[model samples]
Target: MTVIVQPTGVSAADVIAVARGDAQVEISPAAVEAMATSRAIVDGIEASGRPVYGVSTGFGALANTSIAPERRAELQHALIRSHAAGIGAPMPREVVRAMMLLRVRSLALGRSGVRPVLAQGLVDLLNHDLTPWVPEHGSLGASGDLAPLAHCAIVLLGEGWVLGKDGSRLSAAEALRTAGLQPLELAAKEGLALINGTDGMLGMLLLAIADASHLFAMADVTTALAIEAMLGSERPFLPELHSIRPHPGQAASAANIHRLLQDSAIMDSHRDDLAHAVQDAYSMRCAPQVAGAARDTLDFVSVVAGRELVSVVDNPVVLPDGRVESTGNFHGAPLGFAADYLAIAASEVGAIAERRVDRLLDVTRSRDLPPFLSPDAGVNSGLMIAQYTAAGIVAENRRLASPASVDSLPTSGMQEDHVSMGWAAAKKLRIVLDNLTSLLAVELLSAVRGLQLRAPLAPSPAGRAAVAAVTPFAGGPGPDVFLAPVLESARAVVSGPELRAAIEEAVGQLR
Candidate 1:
C-alpha cells in the first residue's frame, strides 16, 4: 500500500515504512493546493524583484548579492550542483529512502514555496525505487542537511547518479528513463526548498527510535534469561516493588521479567535455596532499573521524532499572509540531543549485559558451571574470548555516546555560527545500536549455555522458548568448536525477529 504524505499528518512510523518497507508514497491533494499557494508567493516576489532570501538573491554569506531575473533559475541549479559536495561512501538504501521521504513530507506542508511538481519528483523516485546516491558525510545539520540533501536534489535534475533497483550505479538520466520519469528543471527557490531542511538527520533519528523500542522489549526477555541462568530469584520484579518507583518503563520492564519467568522449574529448585547473597548482583537485580531507564529515554526521543515528522523546517518559509521569513527551524540541535541521549541509554544497557556475561564466565561467580561455561575448561577456552568481544564493543559504545550537539563549529565563512553536529550524532548512534545488538547476543548465548548445563532443572516456559530459539544458532552448545560463527548466528537471532517471535509464541506477546 502507498503512504500518503499529507502536509500535517506524517508520522515517524510512516518514514520507517517508506524507508525500510518498500512502500510507495503519494502527496495529498491538500498538500498540492498548499504548495501551489506557496509557489504563487515565490513567483510574485520574483516578478516584483523583492529581496526575498533564496528567491531573488544569493545564499549564505552572499545573500546580499542579488541574482538577475534571467539568471535566477541558473542560480538554483548551481546551488544544487555546488552544495551537493558530500563525500564518502553512499548511505544505506533505507536511510536514503528515509531522507527522500522526509524531504517530500516537509515540502508538502506548503511553507517551502516549492512547486508541487518538485514534491512529486521525490515520490516518483521512491515509487520507482530509484534511490539517489547520497553520501554518508557532509551534513553539518545547520541550515538543514544541506550537502547530503543536495546530493538527492541533484539526482532530480538528471545530473548525478542514482542507485538502480538492482543496486548497480546508473546515471540519473538512465534511471529516470527506466522508471519512466522525467528529470525536473530547477525553478527559482525550488532547489533551495529541495535541500534546505532537517530531513536527513530526522530520518536517522526516527530509525534509531524504532530500533531502541525493539531493544527495550528484547532487553527484558534477555535479562530474564540471565536471571534464571544465575539461579536468581524473581522477587525484585514484584508489582508492589515497581509500583513504588512509578516509572512507566520500569514498571513495564519489571512486569515483562516477571511474566517471562512464570512457571519456572529452575526457580522452583531455588525456592528453598538462599544465601546466593540473598540477592543477585545489580546486573540482575537492577536490570529493570537500567534497561527501563533506556526505555524511558526512547520514549522521550520518540516525542521529538513525532514533532519533526510534521514540521515545516525550510528556510525563508512562505507565510500564509504571503511573507517569506527566515527561521532557525533547520538547525539539527533537537535531533542531535535525542540521538546522543539515546546512545548513552543504549550503551548503559549493553554495559550491564556485558557484566552478566563476565559473571557467567567465572567459576566462583557462575556457581556449579565450569569456568568460561566450558566442559573441558582449561583445554578448550570455551566462550572466554567471546566475553572479551562483548567488553570491547561495550567500551566502544561508551566512547561513541559522547554528545555531538555540544561540539558545534562555525561555518559558511562565519556567516553560520554554532552548527549542530547532528549528522555525526545520528551516525555514531547507529554504531551504538549495531554494537549493542552484538553485545546482547553474547549475553543471550552465554546465559543459554549456562542454563543448559543445569539440565533437569528446566527454565520457565518462556525461558525454554527463548533458549530453544537461540540454541539452533549455537548448535545446542558443546565442547568448544568454531566459536565465531556461533556468535554471529546468535547475533542474527538476537537482532532479527526469530528470537522475539519464538519467545512470544510461549509468552503470548511481551510488553
Candidate 2:
C-alpha cells in the first residue's frame, strides 16, 4: 500500500508500517509550503550577510570562526565528511527507513530551512527501497544525533553509501542516478539543518517502544494461559475488585484475563473444589498489577514518541517571516528517560514470567503435576534445566534495567556537558525485549507441559488452541534436546497473526 505522509501528524502505527515495508511514502503539499517558507528565511539571512550560528560560522565549540563566502560549499561538504564518525555494526535496514521518514517529517514542518528537493530525496529513497548504511554508535544524543545523522545527511548530497534493493552497497550518487534523480546542492543553512536533529535516536526508540507495547499485551495473554495451566483461582480477576480502584490498565488486564479464562469446564469444575482451595500465589493472583504497570509506562512513552516524531529538533529554526532563531530542542533527554522507563517495564515482565516458570517446574509448588513435569520422575530430568535458563535471564535483566539516561559523560571538550545517553538506552531496551520474549516462550512451554499432566480436565478454548499451536514442536519434553527450534516455534505463536486470531475467536466464544 502507498503510505501517505501528511504534514498533519505521524503515528507509531505509521512508523511500524514503514519499517515493515508494508507502506511506501510521499510528501504532502503542506510539507512543500513549509519547506519553501523556511528556505526563503535562509535566503534572506544570506542576502543580509548576517552571521548566524551555523549558516555563516562554525558549530558548537568552534562557533566563533568565520567562513569565507567562496568556500561555503567546501565547508558544508567538510561538515558532513568529518561528522560521519559512527562505529560498530550497521543499524538494521528498517531502522534506517524509519530514520529517513522521521527526518522528512521534521523537515517538512519547515522550521529546519531544508530545500524541498533535499527533503523529497528522502521520500524518493524510501519509495525505491534504498536505505543508507548507518552505524550503531557515535551519537551522544545531545546537539542531536550529530555523527549518525551526518551519515544520513550525506545521502542528500549523494556522497555517502546506500544499500540498493538487492542488498549491494553503492555510492549514494550512483543509487540516486540509477533511480533517475540528481544530487542536491547544500543551500544556506541546509547542512546544519539536515544533521542537527534527534531523529536517529528517536527512530530507534520509537520502533522499540512500539514493539514493546505489543509484547506487553502478548505477556498478558501468555501469563493468563500459565495461570490456567496451574488451575489458579479467578478471585483476583473479578471486575468488582478492580472497579474499586479503577486504573485503566489494571481494569483492562483483569477484563482480558477474565475473558481468556471464561467458559472453561476446568475453571467451572474447580470453582468450589476443596482440593484446589481459595487462592493461588501472587505471580498467578497479581498478574494484572504487574502487567498493568508496564501498560501504563507504555502509554507515557507513546506521548513522548509522538511529540519527538513531529518536532523540529534542529538548531537555528528558520521562521516563515524570514528570521533565523537558534534553539536547543535537539537534546534527547526526554526520549532518554522514556527509553529507560520502557527497559524497566520489560524487566518486570521477564521477572514475573521467570517466577511462573519456577512454579511450573517445582514439584513442591506445582500442586499435582509430576516432578519437573516428567513422565518418569526418577529416570528423566524433564524441564529441570529450563527453569535454570529462565532464572539466568531474569538475573541478567536486573543489570539491563539500570537506567542509561541517568548517567552522562561530557564530550566535545565539555562544550556538550550533560549528554543524554539515549542511544545507549535504545540499544539496551532492544536487548531487554529479546530477553523478555525468550522468558515468555519458556514459561509458555512449561505451562503447556503442566496442563498436559492434568489431562481430561480441558483448558479454556484459547488455552487449548495455544497448546495445540505449540504441541507439534513441543513433543513431551524428554531429555534435553535441541531447544532452539522449540523456542523459535513458540515465538512464532506469540508473534504471529494466526495465534492472535485464534485467541480473539476464543474470546468471542467466552463473551
Candidate 3:
C-alpha cells in the first residue's frame, strides 16, 4: 500500500506501516507547496542580506558569528560533518525510517525553509527502502535531535552511510548514484532546516506509542484469561458499576472483560459456588482500574503524539510571508513526558500480570488447581520457575519505570540547560515493552495450564479459542523445557490478527 504523506494529518498506524516497510510513501501536493513557500522565504532572507540565526549567521552558542555568502556552502557542509557526533550502537532500521518520514513530514509542512528536492529525497529513500544509519545516542532531545538528524542529513550530502535494500551498508554516494539520485547541495538555511527539528524524538516516541497501544489491548486479553484461569468473578466488570464514575478507559476495559468472559461454562458453573467467597483479590477484581489507568495515560499520550506528529517542530520556522522566525519548538519535553507516562503505564500492566501469575502458580493461593499446575508436582516442577522469571521481570520493570523526564543534565555548555532526556525515556520504553511481553507470555502459559486442569469445566468461548490456538505448542505439564519457543508461540497468539479475530468471534457468539 502507498503511504500518503499529508502534513496536517497522519495517524500512528501510518507511521508503523512506513516503519515496517509495508507501505510506499508519497509527498502530498500541499506538502510540496509548503516546501516551495518555505524556500521562497529563505531566498527572500538571503536577498535582503539579513543575518538570521542558522541562515546568514551561525548556530547555538555561535549565533553571533556571521557567514560570508561565498562560504555558505562550506558552512552547511561543515554543519553536517560537525554535528555527526552521535555515538553508541546504530539505531534500528525502522527507527531510521520513522525519523526520515518525520523529517520529511516536518519539511512538507512548509515551515523548515528547506528545498523541495531535499524533502523529495527523503520520500524517495522511504519508497526505495533506503535507510540512513542513525545512532541510538547523542541527542539531548532538545535543539532538534541534532546529532542523529545530522547523520541523516549527511546521507543527503552523499557523505554518510546508508543501508540498501539488500542489507549491505554502502557509501551514501554509491547508494544515491545506484538509485539514480544526485547529492543535495544545501541552500541558505537548508542545513539548519534539515537537522533542526524534533524528528528523532518524535519518530521514536510515535513508534513506542503505537506499540504501547497494541500492548494495552494484549494486556486486556491476557488479564481476562488470567481471571478465568483463577476462576475469578466477573461481577466487578458490570457496566452499571463502571457507569457511575464513567472514565472512558475504565468503562471500555470493563466492557472488554465482560465481553471476553461472557460464554464461559466455568464462570457460569461457579457463579453459585462459594469456594473463595464473594470477591477476588485486588489484582483480579481491580484489573479494570489498573489497566484502565494505563489506558487513561495513553489518552494523554495520544494527544501529545498527535500534536507532535502534525507539528512543525523545527527551529527558525519560515513564515509564508517571507520571514524567518526562530523559536524553541524543537524542545522535546512534550514527547519526553508522554514517553515517561507510557513507561509507567506499561510497568503497571506488568506488575499486575506478575501478581496474577503468582496467584495461579501458588498451591495455597490457587483453588482446586494442582501444585504449580503440574500433574506430578514433585517431579515436573511445572511452571514454578516461570513465575520466578515473571517476578524478576516485574521487579526490573519497576526499575525501568523510573521517569527519565525528571533526570536532566546540562549540555552544549549550559546553553542547553534543562535537557528533556527524552531519548532515555524512549529507550526505557523499549525495555518496558520487553518486560511486558515476557510477563504476558508467562501469564498465557499459566492460564492455559489452569484451563487444562479445569477439564470439562470449559472456559469462556474466547478463552477456549485462545487456549486452542496455543494448544499445539503447549505440551502437557512436563520437565522444565526451553521456554523460548513457548514464549514465541504465545507472542504469536498475542500479536496475530487471526488469533485475536478468533477470540473476538467466539465472544460475539456469547453476546
Report the number of the highest-lDDT candidate: 1
TM-score, candidate number 3: 0.96
Off by over 4 Å in 2: 164-174, 477-480, 509-511
Measured against the true structure, the TM-scores of the candidates, in listed sequence, are 0.98, 0.95, 0.96
Please, what is the whole-model Cα lDDT of each candidate in the order they appear? 0.88, 0.80, 0.82
Q: Which stretches of candidate 1 lie over 4 Å from their true place?
A: 164-168
Clash pairs detected, candidate 2: none
User: How many angstroms is residue 95 displaced in model 1 relative to the true structure, after the best TM-score fit?
Assistant: 0.3
Better of 1 and 2 by lDDT: 1
The digit string of per-residue lDDT tens for model 1 on 1-511 reads: 6899887857787889999999989889999998999999889988888788999889999999989999999999999999999888888899999999999888989898989999899989889888998888899999989999999999899878887667667799888887788889888998899899889999999998888888878888888888888788799999999999999889989999998888888878877875555878999899999988998999899888888887879998999998999999999999999999999999999999999899988999877788898888877888999999999998899899989989978888888988998998998999999898898889888889988878878888867877787776676546778888888888787778877887888887887
Candidate 3: misplaced stretches above 4 Å?
A: 7-9, 164-168, 509-511
Better of 1 and 3 by lDDT: 1
Range of the 10 consecutive residues with the lowest summed lDDT in candidate 3: 502-511
Model 3 residue-pair collision total = 2
